[model samples]
Target chain A: MTTQDTTYLDQLEAEAIHILREVAGQFEKPALLFSGGKDSITLVRLAEKAFRPGKFPFPLVHIDTGHNFPETISYRDKMIERLGEKLIVGYVQDSIDQGKVIEQTGKNASRNALQTVTLLDTIAANKFDACIGGARRDEEKARAKERIFSVRDEFGQWDPKRQRPELWNVYNGKIHKGENVRVFPISNWTELDVWNYIRREKIELPTIYFAHQRDVITRNGQLMAAADFLNIDEHDRIEHKNVRFRTVGDMTCTAAVESDAFLIDDIIEEIRSSKISERGARMDDKVSEAAMEDRKKGGYF
Target chain B: MDLLKFFTAGSVDDGKSTLIGRLLYDSESILADQLEALQQSNRKNDDGTIDLAILTDGLKAEREQGITIDVAYKYFQTDKRKFIIADTPGHIQYTRNMVTGASNSNLAIILVDARNGVVEQTIRHSFIVSLLELKHVVVCINKMDMVDYSEQTFNDIHKAYSEIATKLHLNEVTYIPVSALKGDNVVNVSGNMPWYTGKSLLDHLETIEVNEDEKSPQARMPVQWVIRPQTDELHDYRGYAGRVSSGSFHVNDKVTVLPSGVRSEISRIETFGQDQAEIHSGMSVTLHLKDNIDISRGDILVNSSHEPIVSQLIEADLCWMDTRPLDDSMMYLIQHNSKQTKCKIREILHKVNINTLDKIPADSFQLNDIGRIVIKTADPLAFDLYHENKQNGGAILIDSRTNLTVGALMFRASVE
Candidate 1:
């Protein structure tokens, strides 16, 4: 406050923290959707800023796909432990095991879309009235149209047409029984904003974010990290490369970019000059034109 | 870099989305994959360039109908500033959506078609921007190529809009001639309009000063939550959590909790991992008070000297948003900042004709109708006038039964 200058990251941080507090001020039982990705990691820090000395009014919840990178899962655990916050992870495999959701098959099939079912089931089990996400509007076209306090019906369906007008900083979390809200505190932050903010905050992430030598399969001019969770086709060839992930999702879907951005500053510089979008490397978005919109209509965060 | 939040508003087919696309495209913000998708969509123009309007039409129905139904936010950063563009729908029915978009923006881009300069939609959109008290207005006379980029046409349109700007009391209005499609004077200087020597649209945008509302004199913070770390190490901690809506607050500054009229001194200002002696507008920080006052989520902390008006009956400009219309017979929830209270419409003043800006007698209010009304809240709301201080003046009407945000209200003054 003493300085006359407040950077854009400071503005974004304040907005995100204000939203996090609104979720706490209104909802009785809310949960932070912690994916341990860069966005979610930033959200965790904002939550701390919002309610640190006091415990986070809600617990950190993760809908683990089980096919996630071991490094990401381990990093998530460590961060949660260090913050002394409770974490409740709902695995996609459990949903499959309980006959609640069918496991997808095929080489290109992924548990990414199946996360919606597991997520809704987890919400029901915990009776969470609100679930905060790290979804940014700049990532996708459909996401750009979503509200910060995205209200979903009992079936977790989004009615884009009937979305309420979000005026000023005032958010209305009013919902009847069997309804929940999916809050995105970082809806305004772009990919570059995230990297710049991460660098400024010096937040730590999994090694996957930084460059490392990993076994990857070349697919459609992109590299997919080689993992046991993925099926190796006869046409696919495994090769070792120094690559890092722009977005860390299921190994079956997330593609890595060849880079040597071992530092946060390096990643920021690379992202500044990069032409392809953050989601461009992800295989899940390449399914169709309205793929994200269609999934969101059916309650896929 | 600083952030500038702005919205684009114009009539249907006025190229609001295309203007945004052109800005992003010409700025080199468009990604390669995004361009590839646009190309593969096979929706190119007659000249073989990808129709940039398709970039913002995110929904399937929107793309199929070739119209924007809701606001699509696009982000791009130049070395000077980071911009958040709220590409809003331009249809008359979606005026509420435009109001929503403009509510959070400090500047507005009012696009006017060169072929039909200063149309009815232009007046309506300008009225909304004025009502919202946005300081900066960039009247981009779009589709200049259709008019051969004639300086005569630009001057005529600019002269016509100057009258409207004066009538609406809109300050800092800038007129630019540009063809968002032909890329004339959008990002770079155009040779078509050699008579015009002013900066291009993006140049003006990148260098223009966005007079922030936070520069207002009054400091207001509606307490959103109370943080008390109940532990042996920090047992006496009681912080009021909220964002500084305007002005600034410093340690040892005397503040009054509204409605209760309790006084307290700021003991500490706390953010994430650091403590500060002061907090400025837009900074979401926690303030510790020397005295434990009766402050809650609905209560607001205001400067004691320049306190806002506290009254149950308030006059405001109301824009009816719901399809069901405004039913004055039932109670509604007036949500102002962190506070929500039951309220009822006491009386309707008059409905303003959006096309002509004339106040006419109207008893019934329908969707997208802007009118003046007197509202009676169950409890007094401490706030400033919408024109004087936007952050403290805005409120929303939520239908008590349906729980839908039925109206957007900007407070004018206390109803005598």
Candidate 2:
């Protein structure tokens, strides 16, 4: 008998690696969805473990909202360069310019929803049979019902009612032409689990994730980063506060929380005691009760 | 902290959702934002308290129907253990959903309303739990407050359930009385039940010793993906990457490829680009064999002396999931572990009536039906019995036309 005891994190890592390998083996053309978030970053590491010593079977794909933080873009580029893998950027601005989608005009206007159009366009154009994502079920109630290998129709619409039953570790990635599967390797992980993994693996993230002085404004009781693209109302007061983002998304919708968790361990400790969910700070989900579900049904990553 | 995966099964109004909500609430796993949203929603119970069932019924249709339709996963953690709860629907029509949720669970929590005692739903759930080979069973007799927290009611229900459990081969059953809405004996000990003395539901979950079956004597590793660098620096790399399904494999262990029976020796074990002396079950790693042989996905490597049964004929118990009845003439795709092969149902021996636990002969199976069937596959499959090793024995049937999973299969035995 082997004397090694498998820890919880180790078991999770194994499960994720197993899923990643299954995707690589099953799909004809697969791509990793890189969002420059901690979950996606951990996914990159797991992919490295799954197919390191060899190049990744699939290229890394990112949907560029054009409202992303500069730090995240730079970090994404450097990581791709270091891994010597290809990166495909699907631009939402390009979709808007091509008249594929209209831009929302308001104080809380975000290109987050428009990313779906560009994403579906890119998937169809590239003929990617499967697109691996870093979505975790513990994040939201809607996602909790998602299968590991979630199948989508040719129109990129998700049917929550008609999902395939995923039994054991065997995943059925079989899909007809024009249909694709969204593979989530870390579907069972929690926010604390992700942070603990990042800390244990010494993974590097963008500086914006750590506590830093940033110009932020309060709106709808959320701390929004005062970026150049953000429209500031006349009554909004901007202040430089020491805050860190619990999640990273389009700069327009993602919100930050007041924290001094400069180090990864400190961030892990903070998340362990956090009363707010990781998605609670995001402004986009607050738009409606089933905002995430609606976006997912429309093929939003 | 340790990890425990459990599933809850009970009929509607049996308080399955309320029980889960109570656990999350008492553990402080429910976030403040979630609590606020629940409070502000108009879907409150009659007592003006926030509807805890709404917390897990995420879909709009589920809320409109006021009953869970599918399996929803919920996570929470205490100081000692992290738990993943698969809150499954209790309706008889959603038995397939219950099977899906209980497939990966180490334990099963069957909720029985104290007022109703042991209903047919309880027997059906316990039967499925036994069929799935779940190790632990917690029979939570909920709604004690409605029964006036009487010890007599608890004892009567407990005695009735013990008889049913014995017939279902559920020996590790634990009965507890509780009121999910009142938070009695769920997360906290109840002062109303002075005659009862036992650990709370959360306390038992926190400290229960999960005894994993001893690793199978034979090591089974199904090749998930073959990693061939083909790079200049690692041109000779031909690594077979997979998770160990059972037992352990070490360097220099004599291994044989299944279906082809190619023999080789493990030269090295690699994990995250580092060489390891050995790899155990549940750990995904790449292995370098001493001799190169024709290997691909769907092939398994095992100890040379302990090869699995490789046959095309198999006997299995299946749970039909699709609305359309399973037809014997149609060919379906049977996916076992990493292997996918075309298969046809050869025969339906008998169907087990979940309510009565009787074996009834049937020609076809409808949705939510559990039956024993014979399968003939085009290719040989190397597998173990479902009672022996779950990872290698479980399989799924996908419809050829719709490409949707139609049924779940557990290998019973190899047919001659």
Candidate 3:
């Protein structure tokens, strides 16, 4: 083995691993919220480092928005199969069928916001005391002020003003029976840091993360993948373009960036010099300046 | 390249947000979309530039109030090094937030407005940096343009701060004149400050060697989880899972499980399905012991030679975070590393008056109060002094009823 000093990536990985173990040790019933995104995939790798030679202390739970990319769902299944871990899926369609949430009706409608109800339901049904997510602080401004172990009320609501102070490396993961905590292991990692870590670990992701030929339509200056899930106007012109996804979510809301950066190295370079923030590709955040904060306070994962 | 995780202590009035905004903006870390949004917003500088503070005032309430209420972490990187800034508010009531941010920082950036040299707020921030024992301190004398770029103004503040630094025993202090609003001495060298021979803030930040690699020689790894795959292929595979907080652990090393003090030998060190002869600090790995004892979660494994002090009574300094005052009768749950146990405040020594460096005798502490207190834990805790080893010495107090973290404890010693 060659000797190399610990880099920033290693430091981040170590911190994340420590956090994962803390979740395991603190909570009785914890779940990993997986969306098959690059961030969740990174969390899966960290969970392996945190708990190996033993079945994971918790199963992976996915709150399916039902408008998700088919690639992400398939990738999620196969990855869980390979890791020999359990996966629990909560579908937004089921929540709609049960009258727990109403489906928005519009050409720009999306099931993204509706996923929070399904997620909260899934948590209560499973009695999960802690739900570990791949939320990063650098992704949004309100998230920048979040604690590593953020406590949520019985309704899964986040109170920005009433957050507990996180000190040193010591985390206090105490909650009532109904109250739960939203644990973010990668709370300190930036988008670039996540990309660099993916490169270093050679972590494989869904094919959509890399560049490929896809049918797309430009709407509000965003190149959206022309999927059936999205309400495509017949008069809208669909164009074939080479693009990759900077972030993965509901196909109706997630936008793609025009790039030929198929390889991980190329993707890193593309992200390094890219002018637009990664969340700029998402249409949901375009709704308002405080869209993310509002959703978070309303129990959006 | 390595990472520098520093804490910046200042309010918006001192141009702290402007300095941070300049660092991120000039480094090209702030993307076009964010900048475009800022430009589109109504908030702007007096001269019609985008109000950079708008970018960091994250919460809507904070934005509406024109003040920071909590600690916000921001990350930016240069070609030389990556950085994580624990940006905290510098208000008198926000001292707890500063303590929270400074606990994890290797360096402190104390922003001082040139017009108001050595103010009360300056002394308060300095006291926190000193209390946290941060080795590297950078005193940025900001708003140089407002002061007409006067070298005398900078020198006067520098001299005034030097006296404070000497009293606080802040090591490796550097003073730099900056105009965060005018982009002077922040990202690049400013032509206006020709007499200022020191490097710009960004340059100094990139080149400073914080020596973060030099962890304490004593090994400490709090056992987080146990891996016992009952599958056919890996039976009898009892592995202790934990991250090495300090020093290193190697195969055949004599180890002792803390709180139980059971002696054992390290049989194997494994990480990511590979066997390793040794694991260093900041590594997440599992170890197989030669003789399995009654080791449970929250047990710390250490080198047998340098055992941690195990005791039921602890003398510590607590920075209160909760709005509720300290109730000695209430049983608080103390979380140290992965361990959790009930604790109570046995005695209150005194509260440190941050501005005056005076220890006022007190028996109670309210929000944002820093005071020494003795704690009685339900179980014996294995730990070191906070100054000697931060990883094992720091803990958090959680209110049993509210389940909110109420105080941050930095252990001084174990008492009878």
Number of the top DockQ candidate? 1
TM-score of each: 0.99, 0.98, 0.98
Residue A105, candidate 1: C-alpha displacement in angstroms: 1.7
Model 2 DockQ (Cα-based):
0.69
DockQ of each: 0.80, 0.69, 0.78
What TM-score, to 2 decimals, does candidate 1 have?
0.99
lDDT of 1 by residue, A115-141 (tens): 999999999999999999999999999
Candidate 2 deviant stretches above 4 angstroms: A1-3
In model 3, the clashing pairs are none
Which whole-number lDDT from 0 to 100 does residue B196 have in model 3? 94
What is the alpha-carbon lDDT of model 3 when measured against the actual structure?
0.89
Question: What is candidate 3's CA lDDT for residue A83?
Answer: 97
Better of 2 and 3 by DockQ: 3
Candidate ordering by lDDT (highest first): 2, 1, 3
Model 1 Cα lDDT, one tens digit per residue, B1-416: 78889999997689888888899999999999999998899677789988999989999999989899999999998989899999898888999999999998989999999999999999999999998889899999999999988999999999999999999999789999999998999999999899999999889888988756567778888999998888998888788999999888888988889988888888888886578878889999898889977789989998777788999999999999999989888899999999999999999999999989999998878999999999999999999999888889999999877778999999999975
In model 1 chain A, the worst 10-residue window by lDDT is A1-10
Q: Mark the regions of model 1 whose C-alpha exceeds 4 Å error after superposition.
A: none
Q: Write the per-residue lDDT of candidate 2 for residues B204-319, one digit (tens) a residue.
A: 89888884633678798999999988988888999999999888899999999998988999999999878889888888999989998989998999999788888899999999
